[model samples]
Target: MSSSLPSEKALVPFVSVENMMRLVHHIGIETMLAELADFIEADFLRWERFDKTPRVASHSREGVIELMPTSDGEIYSFKYVNGHPKNMAQGLQTVTALGLLAEVSTGYPVLLTEMTLLTALRTAATSAMVARRLAPKGARTMAMIGNGAQAEFQALAMKAVCGIDHVRLFDIDPLATAKAARNLAGKGLTVTSCTSSQAATEGAQIITTCTADKQLATILTDNMIGAGVHINAIGGDCPGKTELHRDILKRADTFVEYPPQTRIEGEIQQMDPDYPVTEFWQVLTGQAEGRRDNSQITLFDSVGFAIEDFSALRYVRSKLDATGLYQELDIIADPDDPRDLFGMLQRAK
Candidate 1:
């Protein structure tokens, strides 16, 4: 029992899937979504202060595994994630993730958590945040084109952040639409299950397409979309996987998280290399415009970004103390003598 024992530096907070779910329930999902949106927006405002890069991806015929990393001088964070559309048919999740946060100076990890849930929250928050700015004013109804695991989160985020009260749902699989409709039954939303994509978009001011296919597919055609609506296309997150018709990209003004990354992974990948696109951060900083007129078509080609995951990790870290939902793991080795690694190990024997 020496007072010289290692301090709390040896322990790192870890949030597991169960703890993350409890934390969400504790904060209330809608409230958490709104707060996460604020955190993401604050980070976007300081976009230039961060080190940003496109996620490094390894693509296979069935799926893609990616590493998304970013740093803000003080803290460093990265998320290990994968997208396997085939997993769903195998009774598995289409996406799964884990994230880590560390100190920039010491290169020591401070937080390790299951990001499968956090990613859903942050992705939905990002979409709702952008919709609040780019969606037509007084927009209350949304068309959710692909009702998968992300459907409820996206719908509630829109309700919580963008004041959406109704969501029209459709999926190639009727079961997904039924699942979404059943889950959203009494969640303060008017949920409608539609048979086709075209039926879902009727009277909806916001259209969100989130299909999970590893190849190019048209979930929304040009004629299916109308003027004065915002399109949040979140499914096309890797090369050769897109959800919109090329003509739609030609007709609408597209905004993205990072141009270089979006051009490689987003719907804009179908466009010319020099095709013009605006980064959403510019809209937040008033350096660029959003939704010029009521008749304008605004498209948020959301391919997800490292900075958004960074913001999510930071947000979860901020809640650890108050919620006490995280566990501390002894992950770092602190020897009596910093340089005597072998000597410290011998003492334990």
Candidate 2:
């Protein structure tokens, strides 16, 4: 660590987990999620402007690590994230991440912050944003099928972005359902803890499945879903991981972020490679149709995308000036003479 404060050029703003939680509390979770949805929706409107691709991932028996990167000609952002469903058994987070935002011109990082919490927030925001467009009109209740780290965020974001006023929670573990219900209480939404996924989906217009299972698991079967409902399948994010059954994909008007990527990592992975799916940005831009009718079963196969993280970085970056919740880290070796590397090292010694 440097004894003296680093110069502005040598520093990058960092938001630690504590600071991140503080910032969320400062903005209020609902308001922050709504703002995040706005940023994500705006980015989707200019979808063609971005340099988009699938996340680069390396999988292991223990878990997977990924790098999700994107840019829109000016600023570039990427998130380094890991997913280990087994980590909870070892007292670890199922997902942890750090993100960076850089100036495209300089290639220098302007912001570097932990993104685990932000990722959950953005994922929920993206789900809610998509729900706003594809969900059945007047969607006031949602069934959250997995009561893990993402359950509370999803419930609240739906309320904030899609006008969902009630959430029914269910998880294979009753404790998980209880935990989610506890977290959701007093949030101005009616919280119900149910015994099973089928029970949770009862009378729900929106169904959000977010179980963090690395293996392919059928959190929702075809029979469990109904007409005029929107499904936000959240946890089928890896090559072999999926939450909804293949039959469900066949019947729903599936929407995805990037087809090339989603085909490999999303719920559509269960289908034939030639399976038809709509690019969600097209719906936002009026280039395609969404929710053809009140009886249409719409599915947002959310594998989580890079642009949402980019939008999240942009949103948090915009708030730093007002929140003052970041630290300047001396991460770059900035010397008086760029070419005199050895001289600078000698001076440091």
Candidate 3:
């Protein structure tokens, strides 16, 4: 390692929430989600290379904060995110995040950016990607049980990636459903606001549950689900936070991102510890079967994982040069002599 500091290494590029929104608009939301899906798929294909583990977490009465980190031998990435289901009532996002990717050898941050909106985007992308594999062939309709910050993104990503053309939405809050319907108006999707979860799933082929309440809420009952439908359960992403009834898990061919973490944070947390689950990467890579037949119910127990954030960071970095949407922050200090930190401070004074 060189004793002298490199200018690029000392300055970290930061993408604020404002810039992240701008970048998404500049790239087009659906297009970015599609590209993000490509990046995520690429990473999942080579899953063994990256160091994967459960997130380090701290839980409070109001919410939970977590650090998700991963490395692929050369580069490393981590994201700081929070989940507060009640924040929306106070005019705040229920979830927010920031992420960074660094060179493993240098151990210096290279890129830093907001992940709140990005998390919604990637969560949707991950859901849509999984649905493409597990959904019934030529599935075109989706029943979205939760209509909140993540609802619109989930609808759009399904349309863009999974070729779903219609979305039926249901939410306990009518305003939320209206907001989601309005946002998705001109996006080339057929959107309908339903009165109940059962109504939303009336004719749907893919069912997506992303409710925000951090409890074991049964958004979908076993009798409500029929054979041959693909279910994307993303909201039940924390301890004691699950959306579907346990009977549904027993009937479906369940799949997950990381079993160790999902066992603690995902819907499967309700099941026995030794419950059988197929890792999604295997389905993506053709190593394991997804839906056996048209009538085989499939479930994706999605609890957001570090590898997804790592892939999102890499995707954002790849776009920076072309978009120039980041500002450099002087977060690290530089000295004429790396060994004389005190002398450098003395000279500055």
Candidate 4:
């Protein structure tokens, strides 16, 4: 190794926000979303190999902070994130995160990256991956309620992974809807801004709710959702927050990433403890069914999960060599002599 290069054990690859954006632009956002879906699906297929748990959260009146951790024997990963809905009004993001990937054997970090953007990508990819299997066949239109930071990513992911050709957008804030519309203008999707949630759902085969408010708000009611459509309710991710009504859950065949977590945080929080839900990994592994019929309604009650973030970090690690978008972070202390820590410090002095 060159003297100029930091010790391998001390150097961890770091992808900063600028690098993440550059990588997204380098790979193209839609293409990256498609690729990420592939990675997420592959991990889901081998779901039993991982250690899964609900995120450990610290909740306050304003927002919640969480630590999501998981491992697949060979590698371990975790993410530190916060959800503060009122931050948007204060000129801050509603969600921000950082993630780490490490070797399970040595417990040494291999990569660290800003996941605020990556989270948006992974969440969109996760939704689209599930929609690919559960949405009505040949689905071409999507209704995107809550056009906030996550709106454009969800639209493009659906377009890339599920072949959606049109997206009808609605939001409580008109500016947010316009922002999403403007961002998605030339992305080969027909963008329509609707006056109401009902208008957005008209003639749409897939409905995605990604609102940011931290409350028990019903973005989609049972009457608005008809047969033969898929609902991707991603906004209701915490204990008190939900985007769909209880009747909708009762009417649809719900799927989830992890039930224990989703029951506490997802749309099904309103349902009984025994509310039947098929884990999506089971669907990918062919152990369960996805869409039963043309008229069947499939609801993916997504609350996000650690395995998905682990896959995202793994995907980023795989791309670091090809993209060279990461910098080596000297975060670990390496002593030349294994048993002479004090001697190594004195030698340095």
lDDT of each: 0.95, 0.93, 0.92, 0.94
Best-to-worst order by TM-score is 1, 2, 4, 3
Clashing pairs in 2: none
**lDDT preference between candidates 2 and 3, better one:** 2
Task: Give per-residue CA lDDT, model 1, range 1-349, as digits (tens).
Answer: 3323554777889999999999999999999999999999999999999999889899888898999999999999999999999998899999999999999999999999999999999999999999999999999999999999999999999999999999999999999999999999999999999999999999999999999998899999999999998999999988999999999999899999999999999999899999899999999999999889999999999999999999999999999999999988878877766787676667766
- Tens digits of per-residue lDDT for model 2, 245-344: 8888888999999999999999999899999999999999999999989999999998989999999999999999999999888897776666866667
Taking all chains together, the TM-score of candidate 4 against the true structure is 0.97
In candidate 3, clashing pairs total 0
Q: Candidates ranked by lDDT, best first?
A: 1, 4, 2, 3
Give me the runs in candidate 3 sitting further than 4 Å from their true place: 1-6
lDDT for model 2, please: 0.93
Off by over 4 Å in 1: 1-7
Q: List, residue by residue over 1-349, the lDDT tens digit for candidate 4.
A: 3333346788999999999999999999999999999999999999999999899999999999999999999999999999999999999999999999999999999999999999999999999999999999999999999999999999999999999999999999999999999999988999999999999999999999999888899889889998999999999999999988898988899999999999999999899999999999999999999999999999999999999999999999999999999999988766665575666556656
Candidate 2 weakest lDDT stretch, 10 residues: 1-10
